[model samples]
Target: QGKNKKVIILCSVLAVVVLAVVAYMIFKPEEKLAVSTVEVTKQTINETLDTTGTVSTASEQSFTLMNKVKVKTVNVKEGDVVKAGDVLATFDVSSLETALNEKENNYEKALAAYNKAKNSSSSASGKISSTKKQIAELEKEIETLKAKTSTTKPSSTKSDSGVKVSDDLVKRFIKIAKRFGVEYDEATARRVLTSILSAGSSTSDISGLLDNLGTIAGGSGSFDMSAFAQMSGGSSALINAEMSLVQLKAQLATLELQSNDTYLSVYKTVYENAQSEYQKALTQTNEMKKGWIASEKGLVSEVNIKVGETVETQTVVDGKDVDISSIISSISSGIDVSKMISSFFGSDKVGIKVLNYPLVADISLSKYDVLDVSVNQEVSVKSANNEIHEGRVSYVGAVATSTGSSLDLNSIMSGGGSSSTIPAQVTIEDGDKSFIVGTDVDISIITDTQENALVVPVEAIIIDGSDVYVYAYNKDKSTAVKKKVTLGISNDTYYQVLSGVSEGDVLIKNTSGLEDGAKVKLK
Candidate 1:
């Protein structure tokens, strides 16, 4: 009976304690924890593509000797600015010049002889030779006539036939001499024909002469002889032998005159032609030796040679007809496939080791990313030291680059396939030699911008697994309610709300210890 009574008292006391605790909670609510909130508002958001690049030199060049060479002069020092064609160095060419000089005189002599030989056309020499033969024959004919007159009987002109001076022969003689470009008259023709017969003129020449004379005399068979009797005859024959002798003497005088005047005139012309050719060769040599030529405009950064050096060279011999290689090198020797740099052939070793100031960054981007990048696009670069540089895009490559040392954005988070890149060049403003070449730096490209977007503090957006939500004040402001939101681009400080949120809703900025549909009070 006493145990039952104790149990009933204990149960009754627990009910009274529970009623007291309930009465205190109903009378005094828990104070709302103070927290800060922000109203959703319209603002601007920038969408940027971030990248990186290495600083590098713009251009470079190198100098070298062509072979086992001798240096004649060093014309430039390091760090000198020079224009194209400026002498950077020279090779010793004195021995070559001396050898060339020795050969030059001989070359000129041979050249003059060849040109003179060519200039005195075959026709001119042939005419001179024929004239000499004609003169000798005229002299022989006169001698023959003298001997015959002393041994044989005298005769009238009609009986004289040994030396032809008739109308037919005179016409024939004139045609033969004139056809060969020799100036002739009737006296000259008579002398030449008698001379021709004395030297034994060919039968073909005689026939050709007769045929041509027939055309000139208006007859086809042969020219009339009597009609041409002494058209310029000096004297009639007392006897046939005297007539032949007198004509022979006259022919000798005409030939003798032509031999002295016409033959010597051709000889003088040939001599003058040789001298003129020599003079022209000397003039051309002078013009060709005006010194070396320049190829481009730039600073002369190096000089590789000095004066008084010996170099071996192969000699050219025209007589033996040997092909000798040239020792001198061209400007293009220093500029070709081996020393070239571009998208086609990687890059060249810099002639100058260090380059800075007005820096250029060689940035690589994905193929898709580079399509939007163009020449002269604005860029902002952040160095490893957190220094920001503003610049313009200089070049955007069309072709893709092969795999290299850079880490792709996809590779940082998830596994990716093999990737290619397009290279770009950016020129930083006022670099002032502060940036070192070949060092990597961060870069950002402002690709897009959104204006007047419904935005909220980045801290206000909460991620619940795959979904994003924001907490907002209820209508009475007694508690906070959860509002889901869709997001666009986000800058450093704000989130651009695309949907699921409004521009006027009050948002919870400080979300510590906050949950969706959780009670909250704005501070």
Candidate 2:
């Protein structure tokens, strides 16, 4: 009975204690809590693409040397202003001097040969003149003899037998005598009767001759008897004289022809040959002299060999020696110096210049974000040093590359495939030399903005995908109500409200412990 009474007393005491605790929980007044609220705001938002690139220069030039000779001097340094005809370097000319001497000796030999050929021609011409004068004197003597012989002869037409007078011959003699002007017309009749008895022609033949006399007399009008006698008497003497003159003239002509063939023709050949040889020698000498002068003038810009360095006259292209002056001219004039120097020296110079200010940056963007980037767009860059610069986007690569692969969620979340990009040129309106090229930077592009925006804290709004809701506190600060809200542009900290929320409303921010229409205390 005592045990039972103890258990019963314990149970009654526990019940009274629980009832007192429940009465205290149910009857206690709610305490007032201070809470902060934000009104819904409307604003603008922006989307942009970001990329990076490096800067480079505009122009450059390089110089190289041609021949392998000692470096006599380097007239121009890297930054020197070299004109077209500037004296750059010089080489020893002792070898060219020896070549010039040999050419001069050859020219002298040609001149001597030409002089010898000229003298031989003058001697032959004098001999030909003297021979022609002798022939002219002989022809004059023959003419005088022919005149005397023709005057002494009178009708002396006998054969080589030299038979004398017959009556027929006497008659012909009288005719010849009259025709030869040896007798007058009256003397002719007496000479004819005398010739008839002397030549012993019959009377009948004499009568025939008299009958034909009229026919023969027809040609007697212009006849000169003395000239005919002279012609008959001197015919052989005149022929002999003409033959002698012809022989002398032929000898003189032959001598002149031989002189022309031997001296004029041969000497002309020799003179032409000598002139050609002398011209060749003079050309070689002039070349050597010019080469020496060029070496002295320091026109050769560079030489690879030392003072005792041995080098062959190497054929640059199929037996052509290197022309040092042409190379120097090409280099000084900015011609094809690279190819010329390369052919001579077997190497080329690479020249590059960095003209514009260059800035390099590494940037990453999403495929959807690539469209907003382009060349020459203004960008706000924040450097690693926390310094900010205003620049224009100069370039954006069309392809995307990986940043890195990592096991972290943030790294995996950033991993992506190929993303299209636009390169933009950004000109820094203010030149800032402190920003070094190749520096990585953070960029944000402002796509949109709004003034006097009615905004609320992002945390105060509840978002289930696209559906958004907010817990509005009632006037009593207890019993908060859930209200659906229309939203607008948003940033990291604030959300723009388009509708369903107004100014001065106390919206619930931490709705984790609250239910729809549930009693809520603001703190």
Candidate 3:
């Protein structure tokens, strides 16, 4: 019985010990977690706007030629320096020479035609003047005869049979008789004859007076019988003289009309022909001076054409063909070929090389941040080589890039894809020629800076909307108290403390699972 009892006691003791161990394992407080913490510190903080861009050369050039003719001689090679009046190349002039010769012949022909037309016009003008004078003289002579026939009266001798007029008397009497009532016989006839002799009547007025006289003589009227008989006999004679004058006047008028018509025709034709010829000659001369064969003076740096090489007419510039002669002459002179090329091609001096720098971290910055970014701010450029370079903020696009849809392969292929970030230009300031234009580079532009500023590790601060909170650890590390803080500029790993947390305050570096009022133990 004693031995059994002792064994029971040993078992009981083992059960109690086992129970105590289990209780200790189940109820022991959790060992305090050893958390890393940082103390608020005073330091300088720099806020930067980071992006990427490329580098490019400042100057470049290109050239083009205009002449399509076979190259005869190339005077200069590429990169040759030439001066003004240098011949760069030459084209076969055989064709141009032939054309010029043909133009010269045409010009000579035109000139001859012009001279002949001019002479004919001048001769016609002289004949017109002579004909006009002859007409005037004939008119004057007719007027003189008319005046004599009008006033002269015939002498009559009285015989057994009334007044016996002599033939001369009869002729004179007939001339006067013809005037009779038609020409105012004695009184008006004498006045009209005197007016004509005195040049008192205009040619038109004189002709009208003659017509009136003829009408009067031809009409019947009362007068002295013998006188009337004598007048009647003279009437036929005066009428004949007047009719002859009329015929002569009509002939003179016809001659004047014919001469005028001939003169006008000749003058117009000749003048027109001469003008046309002169214009043609002038045009030909100008063309010869300005055409392909015309020699020019200029510097030519590059000559693409070789001897006997056929080339198409190249547009050297936007709308102007290359002046073949000028180019050839320029090439002969050692001028800068690059400048010539640039001028010919109408290209920008600097060639842009676009590089694809893939986007890393893009975020919409607030309007307040946008205003801080400006041109020429020094920044850090991170290249593909993992090298950092100094850069400047070259541009900041005003408009934001649009982004709302999923990736569109078509848009990407067509280079029409959109994004949310604003476009900006950064120029690499530090780097050798190894940096190419349009190369994508990472850039960080310093937007703000503060010296000896109150700062804390970025991990220490918790951002919730606009409100920033930090967990402040007690000196004993028994608890972490949540404290609100106002912040300033922030860099990659640190934040500038504007208010709240001060130096010497221990701040929690990691706040992943911490709550606003969570209790904590320090290890």
Candidate 4:
């Protein structure tokens, strides 16, 4: 009985211990899921884009000949470095010299012709004036004869048949009788001359007065010429006056023809045409004398002619000839020649090609990063041999590339497609001849930057449709709460936090499977 009592007591103690352990296991609270978190901190975020590109000449000047001339010597070849005032090539100027001499002679001839034409015009004006004077003198001589005739008239002091012959009376009778072609007697002729001489009319009026005197001889009536001459000066005086009148009329006709100006105009036109042709030849000769010289310091990108080749401002493209003279002239006009010397080789000089120095890189940007690039932006270039160069964005293509193809370094490095890249230009500040043109190089452009800005790892940010958010870890509650964020520029590893997060704010570093408002433990 004593043994059974001790065994029962032991069994009861064992059962109570087992029941307590089971109760504790069933009542324990659940532990939270552990997560890695990060603190939002102020940091500098440099937004950059990297790509590959080619080094090429930024501004190439093509040296072309405006006239066909034989090359005398080629001082430089392709890839030659040249300085301002360096002679690029020499021409056989024997042709140029001959042309210049011809042009000079032509100009002198043109000038002489112009002067001769001017003198001829002056001489013509003088001839016209002298002819007019001669006509006037002849008219005066005719008037003088009329006066002599009046003085010698037999009926000077009286009228025939007792008719009153007043000075004014005789003049009126003569004028009316002549207009109607009436015959007059010798006494009437004598009276008419007496009246005209008394009036002392001008030479211009005397010619008309003499023409009226024909009335005396108009009819079949017996008005003897001898009787009329006796009343006037004499037959000889009348004949001399009539001859002078005929000579005056002939001279007036000649003067009228000269005033038409057709002859003088022909000479003037010839002079102007000669002058124009001379000027054209002079311009051509002057340019030919210049030969070829470097206008600015640069590398010779091409040398198209041999030592004896005759070159012209023409070139063949796709088997068709084209005039590149105008195009070349247009390019030359844009160069700033202020830094270059005016002459080389004892004459004013210019070249067929003028290449401004320094190097540039041509790169492409994709639609993903095109908006982030612009002119004057900082850039870094790297060669295949790992040489780094500093540069700036000089040109951004305003239109899409026509080929729709480009080498996008960003896409290439990231193993992405390059179909959307647009062309861009970078001026390598310290680039030199060491860089082979058309060779590929790596390029990185500083597209954006932020200083002392709140940022978080790109992985920490969550994309929910159009909204971007992050899980904020609450230190007091030991829980993660969903907080929306406004992001600014982003780099490879982090994003500039614009809003909804502050410096020192804790965030869930990896939100891959984290739930909103879920319990968590700090890592």
Instruction: Please provide TM-scores, in order, for all candidate models, with all chains considered together.
Output: 0.42, 0.36, 0.38, 0.39
| lDDT tens digits by residue: candidate 1, 1-523 | 9999999999999999999999998997766756688889997777666777898656544542222244556565654555555655555443434544534553455455434434543444446556556646655664576566567674333221476656676666666445334445787667545544433444355555455443323211122333223222221222222333333333333333233333333333333433443344344233224322234433343443445545333332221111100100111244332121111111222112223245688988875687668887778887656888898788888888766556776444456555567888888764533455678877777666789988888888898798999888775856778877888887667889989878788887888887565666666
lDDT of 2 at 226: 34
Estimate, for each residue in 86-201, the C-alpha lDDT of model 2 and write its tens digit.
Answer: 44334443454453344345445545654654564466577877886787687677667566655766333222233333555455645754643555354444443333323333
Using TM-score as the yardstick, the better of models 3 and 4 is 4
Best by lDDT: 4
Positional deviation of residue 238's Cα in model 4 after best superposition, in angstroms: 63
Answer with 1 or 4, whichever has the higher TM-score.
Answer: 1
Ranking of all candidate structures by their TM-score, best first: 1, 4, 3, 2
Name the lDDT value of residue 121 in candidate 1. Answer: 38
What does the lDDT read for residue 139 in candidate 4?
66
Q: Looking at candidate 1, what is the lDDT of residue 493?
A: 79
Over 143-172, each residue of candidate 3 has an lDDT whose tens digit, in order, gives 675566568863222121332223433344
In angstroms, the error of model 3 at 523 is 9.1
Error of 4 at 453 (Å): 2.8
Candidate 4 C-alpha lDDT tens digits along 396-421: 98777543455555557887554455
